[model samples]
Target: MEPGATLLNSTLQQTDASVSLLWTLTLVPLSGETPRKGPATMPLFGKSHKNPADIVRTLKENMAILVKQDKKTDKASEEVSKCLVAMKEILYGTGDKEPHTETVAQLAQELYNSGLLISLVENLQVIDFEGKKDVCQIFNNILRRQIGTRSPTVEYFSSHQEVLFVLQKGYETPGSALNCGIMLRECIRHEPLAKVVLHSEHFQDFFNYVEMETFDIASDAFATFKDLLTRHKVLVAEYLEQNYDAIFDQYEKLLHSENYVTKRQSLKLLGELLLDRHNFTVMTRYISKPENLKLMMNLLRDKSPNIQFEAFHVFKVFVANPNKTQPIIDILLKNQTKLIDFLSNFQKDRSDDEQFNDEKTYLVKQIRDLKKPAS
Candidate 1:
């Protein structure tokens, strides 16, 4: 054989073997699970793995391949996605085959110890679109793993909260944003993870993300930000109270941002946080601020009816404060007649929202009856 022919044959053999290994590893059945269909599972160099730990090890190896390859070929990513799907199938059964609880539990522990989740998220930018989705599914499934009343994945992340924050950094990467945001929301659903993120110094970064130039990234981030703030009400209330001035300082900027979406979402979130009974102290403090009241009043006049409507939900809190501060009362009295006229006409098209109209009338009556602190 010619030297070039031998070289080409060697290359083809190597490629074929790599595919065989990936395929073998990809379809490798967990302990006691049924053998997968299609190509039969084979030995690696010679050793075959049937333990559930082998599944986790295989995942970590492919995940490493994704991380190490700065310039990933389509074939490489396809193999990784296949591995991810296999892992997902193990966690959630395919068709009539229910997943083996013991196998899943073993896989969950192996995944946590292997540090695969962190590696996957940190290298998510290198992954292709479809593979990113696969990673999201795999990560979310692992995140849902539980033992009795306790969630092991959530516990793992509570100490390794940086993984969630790493996911947040992806918000800046165009390919990574929505995928990262999805995993992020999943983690923060657990109170411990939410508490860590809520208290992270970078927690304020969400403010910047929600106002970015890209609509999809910004909107997805806003959704995650909303979830973190609203998912665990008690944790969120503590976060808001402990970090009130700083939290709302960033929040207040969003209420007036040139990005209309930012302004609308922040206003809506403000109404939600301020009105929740759990956040009574925080809401009381928020409504007492003359500056906050003024911001809400200005938002009331925004050209977008949606903004005006969201603003009303927040603005009414200021009006409804039974123990309104002198400054709050002064602002309401100053804008009393103007507010009545504005609320009277504001979002009038929502005639079906009897509650809104009633609230509007109530706000009108509240301001109208204000005695200006008996001064």
Candidate 2:
């Protein structure tokens, strides 16, 4: 064979071998091993051999799918459900083992970084019954997380405050209300998050939420609303002062609410606030109005003993305020006889309360001293 022919044949044969190797590489898996996804990957069997981050990551992806569709697929739902259960166990732990603190810290940080909390709450309707509970547990557990004195999770919430309002929106959805309430209640325990909720325009919605037709939801909403107004007294005082007109306007509506519970609770809360030293300014402002005095006076005669009792507690404040507005003084003087007569017989069953007996005596004298209209 000639040198040129032999060289060409050798080149062709080498090219054919290279082509065969390339085909084999593309067509076959080496040793049949699939690429490892991560520890705690789904079909999660039991506990994962990998990191909890895998659970957070998989759960986040599944949640994205769940959030986009109103009707979630069972497979995705179950997968997310499984991850939620595992997440709960990871954060709160099982009976047999405590959750590793470091692991939880890592997971909490990752969850925030991924914005999973925002997604979970905004799409809470997609999670199933038990899964919704797991979501709540997961959130509260993470919310309790703090590094040193600095609460990283609280900071995350402060930055992503929309999550807090989404929880508020949950009140309208019966399925998610209590769960959202639980989460929101926890969030507000941290001052930053509470301030965010108190200052937001959404705060107005809480008035309506507390009045919703659903008994449990309205009750839950009232609990949250009360906390917002009373939890951080200093913060609340400032908010009330800045927004007094708006706040008390809604409050007055509650005092006149057709719902018995609403009227009673509002009256009780009014007394509590007006009596609180932190709310001195608000109380003074509230009692300055003759219209407010008239409302409390009317409530003092409400049919329900409980309502009347609560109203009397508020009514005493008006008669007791030394700096009574001129309108307020006129109303007190006009009702002086009726006020003394009513207090003498008011809540007779409360005779056991020494403090109440004394206050009733004090109010009677204050009204009698109102320079009786020369009758």
Candidate 3:
């Protein structure tokens, strides 16, 4: 053979050998065949596999080559999509004569661990609601184990990019919404995910889920849910302006709940929603009521520091406003002891952080001013 032709043949043989190895490793378990542990046996087309570790190492190396080569080819991403589709079908579709649950589960875990599943989910955009719903079902089943069984899955899915997909796609169906609620509830138990999810566009979808009946299953869904509520001040302000009556009705009902945590969360959400210029007129009606002030005064003594802080902050804001200042003054005269105690505790426990110290100083100044001699 000519030297050039000989070189081309050798290259083709190596390519074929690598491709064969990938196919064998990826499909052998599904085929119920114990993996073979040596070279291809064909001359000039063999790839030695020294051991199980060697097989894995060779498989990873070949996968990288395949990905690189695919990247160079026209429509390589399309080909990859097709491969993913075929893999999904084999794992999720029922058309196969007999599905290998163990192999499929292993592949799902491997994909999740490598972050390929998350990447695939990010790339996914289905215009068809039904198709989106089906994908969500599969994703939910795969992630359910992670959400319920493993602790890390909560953090993993709470990633901004990952939860963004859930927010964008999970609202397609009621079932998907429930799945997202479950995931978010687990995520909020940890601070990192909670912080990310609270500020994300996903938060709107989260509120939507809470508005629906599915919220009953995850009561702690809003345990510290109030903290996130304060972050979206503008959005909450807008929502309250348009939905004040509905919100007030729900707030009233929530206050009667046996779960003090939920009640405090509702109050905090209400406070955030009402802490805007637009809602000021309507909020005055609630804040000025003697009974409402008493309720807030009671809340100031709640065991949860968050509830105490939020109640005092809301009271301060309401009293600072020109329209509600007199009613607030009246309440303060009636509950001077409680107000003094709260201010003293707040100042004593205040952190040295400049911002917190500034707030503490401002509160003390406000309290001093409130006790000024009458003209």
Q: For residues 1-375, could you state the per-residue lDDT of candidate 2 as single tens digits?
A: 246754554454446546545544534335877643332222223233247788888888788777777455676898898788767867886554588898888888778888888889988998999899889989998899878898888998888889999999999999999999999999989989999999999999988988888889999999999889889999999999999999988888898898888778878988898898999999888889889989888888889999988988888888888888889989888777887898899888988999989999999999898874456
TM-score of each: 0.82, 0.84, 0.41
- Off-target runs (Cα >4 Å) in candidate 1 are 1-51, 70-75, 372-375
lDDT of 2: 0.84
Clashing pairs for predicted structure model 2, backbone only: 39-50
lDDT per residue for candidate 3 within 177-213, as digits (tens), equals: 4444444444445555555664455555434333444
Cα-based lDDT at residue 274, candidate 1: 84
What's the TM for model 3? 0.41
Give the candidates in order of TM-score, highest first. Answer: 2, 1, 3
Ranking by lDDT: 2, 1, 3
Q: Please report how far candidate 2 places residue 95 from its true position, in Å.
A: 2.5
TM-score of model 1 vs. true structure: 0.82
Instruction: Compare the candidates by lDDT and give the number of the best one.
Output: 2
- C-alpha lDDT (0 to 100) for residue 74 of candidate 2: 70
149 Cα displacement, candidate 1 (Å): 1.3
103: Cα error in model 3, Å: 27
lDDT of 1 by residue, 1-375 (tens): 246754554454456667666665546689999977545544322332235577667656766666667465555666666567667767886555588898888877777888877888998887777778888988998888777898888888888878988998889999788999999999888888888888889888998999999999999999999998899988888888888889877887887799988888888888888889999999889888899888888878889989988988998888887898888887777877888887888888999989998998888888888875444
Candidate 3 Cα outliers beyond 4 Å, as residue runs: 1-134, 137-216, 219-239, 276-286, 353-357, 371-375
